[model samples]
Target: MGYYAKELEALLRAGRFRRPIMADPEKLDMASNDYLGLAYKRKLLRRAFERVAAYPWHAPKSSLFLGGYHPIHRDFEEALKEANGFAAATLFGSGFLANLGLIEALVRRGDTLFIDESYHASGMVATKLVRGEVVLFAHNDPRDLLEKLADHPTKGRRILAVEGVYSMEGDRLKREFFEIAEWFDMVMVVDEAHSNGVLGPNLLGVFDHYGITPAPRHIKMGTLGKAYGSYGAYVMGSEETIAFLNNRAKSQIYATAPSLLDVALAHEGFDYVAKKRKKLRKKIAKLQKCGVSCGYPEPEGLIVPVPMPGIEEAVACREALAREGFEVGAIRPPTVARPMLRVILRTPLEARHYRELFAHISEWRDGV
Candidate 1:
């Protein structure tokens, strides 16, 4: 304890000390990543439970390589591949693990990984474990990416990573990124955690939204926790790429298979999204309108970030909203470059609630 005391004190002084608090179900949720509100739907839960109960093994007892790959997992993978127009798909314990496994397994020595600077931290951390060269381009700037590519040439494969709807800024990936990847012959990895089930005509994710036919080099990784409202993740790519990951990705080979219940629930979530996409899109558009009316830029997705002056002010604003029976995320340094209130415009929240939230945010921004 004494050895870590100084570091702890420093964090406290910076107003970045962290602790998890119990979620109050009674409060109106405006912070969590359950974009489609599938987490609160009892019908989905009931269906998932029924499905799980019918299976002989409700839990994965071993790694997927060791016979833990159940029919449920395979079915979900198949569904994902079909919906997203990928040749194959594989499941992972979570989005972080998927990203970690992908970067670690795909980028070998002599290879180069050109990633967006604003990509998720998990992918950033994975770079340290790989033997490849990494180059970061300006966030969402394709010109910077092209410049970096011109500056660095590699003998081996080139991989590009970007997010569909960045978590912090809530901005969609630029269309030019896909074109660049194709022109440069790079393997493009799109993290669709925030966009899947929330965007596109089919709500399959960014690929669907952009109407881009996935090439052999295109890879898509998406989480079930956000819009899907479950847990676990899936990666979709060409059949050969997925097979290579199965053989080389230690994270998937060493860890136990994902929970059967979660996968089943996510499958139900996929169906739910398909059935309700039209209504969900309308809800999202309404929230985006409200945000724009309140002086915020129109959100590319469901996340609406309200910037705060500083860390202390961000915390204070969160507490004030909590007192008013609203629960929102007060994001600070390390997670975001600046302090902000992350408001998730979840579909479960009514239009009136959004209006109220925007009003409060406008007041706070104006120092009313």
Candidate 2:
């Protein structure tokens, strides 16, 4: 315990130690990634349960390739493919697994993987396991990416990975990235964990928002846990790409299949988002307006990051907000370079709650 004790002490001294706490449901939530507020929808849950109850097996009970792929999974995958305009789709246990499988399988020897510096940690970790050269471009900078691409030439495939919405920064992927990928003929991987069901006129994702048709080289990965309010992930691409992943993606081939109930619930969530898109957009707009009125920049999606001077100030702000019955995230290093209060402008939170939350944040900023 001596070595572990020293590491724990160091974390405490730097004010970066963390521990999960049970959520206080009594408080107004502004912290979670449930952007659509579908997690708390009783009707949705009941419907999902009804659908799953009809199935003989509650869980997949094995890897997707080995007698585990159920009709529920197939149904959801088909729906996702149709919605996102992809020729094929596949499911994974989570976004982390999806990234691991995608990168590990797609990036072979001689391939080059170009990624956004601010991309999710899962994808960054996946790069370490791949048998390809990994190069990171400046966050959301197309010029940097173009320059980097020219500097690093590969005899094999050039893969580009980026997030639709940067989780902590809450900024949308630059539109120029799509053009750059097309020009370079790179296989583009768009992780839409935060942007799916939030951005785009159809509430599908960035491609839908930009009105770009899915090409054979385009791979879109999205988590069902965030906006969909379920706990799994799915990847969509061309038929050949999906077939290749099915054969080579170790995570999908070895890990237990994604939960049947969660997939069912996510299917319902997808339907709900499609049916109530106009209403959901209004809720998002209302929160964005409130954020601007409170002196914050216009949020590209649901996340609104309130910058903090330091770790202590960030923690103090979180505690102060909690005292006022509002729960928000006090994000600190090494998740971010600096500390900040990560606010999720969830649809479930009322307009009055947004006003109060923004007022509190404004006061905190003023004092800081």
Candidate 3:
């Protein structure tokens, strides 16, 4: 216990420990995943309040199999399934739970899981729990994946897992990579947590964004929080796949089901996203332009990575911007391979904010 305390003190002194922050209304937030600003939108808040005022104000007391499942849960799943073109969908307490349960249940001791090295922490941890051969391929590299698959002499089921939009890098999986997975007869699991409500014509996620249809063996996992401005997660697949999860997935089977309030909020959030899609696209376009103007990579989506080179530089950049009444995330080791400043775009920003941000960056860079 004394050694643990000493290690924690060292981490805190080294600026590695994370701390929670209160929402500052005056500061411009460039760090959050509220891409469309729907999380703080007046409409969604009013809707949530209305739902809470109605019924089930308390937490669902049990897991889905016991007494937690409700009509709203089914309705939410059905709507997501239809929207994403999946035959069935099942809800989870969170994106972490969905990834954990789905991957752990599907892969067995004899199976092989070819996971992208840059997959989310949840999926990474889940792969470790699976009693199988887990091979991590280079991030978004089809050639690397193909070579790895060729080298492995496994006659068991091969599973390929990737993210539709990688959270830290803000890059997406290429179509060629998907083609490689198909050629190898691997079960494809795409986590679209970051792209679900922010991409595609109908906001169905990466499949729709790339104009590709999900195959029968493909499983899609996504969250309701980021772009939907709600909570919980869901997995979309064929009816048989979902049925298997209902009985086999320990995460969903043992955890308390998402409450009525969450279901109502998510349903309302989906509708809100549908209505605001056009305006949100315009915001992304504007943000992309801002990134270019600020001498950063042309942002292809809501997430933008501003290079700061080293850990010290990245921390300095975050602090510099914060001093100017702007709050942006500082990315460091573990979360990413290298240090960089992470910026997330939202809907309410204007051209002047971008110009000012760039000015601050220039000043900070020159030590003004």
Candidate 4:
């Protein structure tokens, strides 16, 4: 505990925590997941705000499982499912809970859980909790999963787990991964937390872009916090799986449903993305021109992950950029392999901001 405290203090001294600042409406901000620049748009804000402002305050008097599931929840679920081509979707409070709930619904004690070695920590914990015999394949390496599957005990069942886009490093899922999932008849769970509103020509996620429909063997978990710029997550699957999760998953059954206002905002956010994804993609492309190394520079969507070596180097670069009136995000693991810097490229940050950021990087003292 002492050692952990000392390490946290080290991070604090470097300004890495850096106040996780709220967006200044007047400032040019890139620190948020508002990739489409929709979160701040007054038009959409007014629409959602109006709905929330009108919500009957008396609704909160009811218990979550009773009559507390608001009309907006159903509306958001329908719209989200329609937008993403899912047969059905169930909302959860956040990505971590969604991932955990999905796993618990799918895996049992006798099952074999094979996960991407670097998959999100939440998915890993979910798989572990059920005491499923676990096998891990190298990141994006489907052949390794196939080989492991050959020997794993089918006395139970198998689930293949991986992220659609690795959140930390900005890497993408290799197409071949789905083939392994298909071949093994393994339940494939794809967490599109980072990729949902960013991938494909339609922002329909990688699976939909590839023309693969997620079936019983395929599950999609998407978060509202990232590209959606809102506050929750949803799992997409067949009606049966959703029903099972709602009944048996501890995270879902125990937690109060999310706020009506949050669901309203989520609906507005997704609607905005559906209409303006092309514009967002173009802006992301222009940003790639200036940064020396942006993870997936041409980006498969709205996220631009800029990598900087050394923890101190990343920290200093972030502070320097922040002081310059730019709000770029600095990410150090437990998110990435080592420490890397990230910049969320909102549509508000035009080509000129990218230029300034690149210029700042050139002489920036990367404190090591």
Clashing pairs in 3: none
lDDT over C-alpha atoms for residue 230 of model 4: 76
Clashing pairs in 2: none
Each prediction's number of clashing residue pairs: 0, 0, 0, 0
User: What is the lDDT ranking, best to worst?
Assistant: 2, 1, 3, 4
Once fitted onto the true fold, the runs of candidate 4 whose alpha carbons sit more than 4 angstroms away are 1-27, 53-55, 58-64, 288-297, 365-368
Each prediction's RMSD to truth: 1.1, 1.1, 1.9, 3.3
TM-score of each: 0.98, 0.98, 0.94, 0.87
lDDT score for residue 157 of model 2: 96
Write the number of the candidate with greater TM-score, choosing between 1 and 3: 1
Candidate 3: tens digits of C-alpha lDDT, residues 1-368: 77589888976776676777676788998888777777777777678668656665456678999978877788888888887788999999999999999889888889999999999999998987898899999998988888999888687889989998889998877888778777888888999998877667766678988887777788999987788777899998888889998998999999999866777788888888778778766766777687576677675567777777677888888887888899889987778888888878777677578668877887887883
Q: How good is model 4 by TM-score?
A: 0.87
Stretches of candidate 2 exceeding 4 Å from the true structure: none
RMSD of 3: 1.9
Model 2 lDDT tens row, 1-368: 78599999999999999999668999998999999889999899999999889988788888888899999999999999998889999999999999999998999999999999999998888899999899999999999999999999999999999999999999999899999999989999999999999999989878988998999989999999999999999999999999999999998999999999999999999999999999988888887777776678888988899889999999999999999999999999999998999999988887678778989988877888
Name the candidate, 2 or 4, with the larger lDDT value. 2
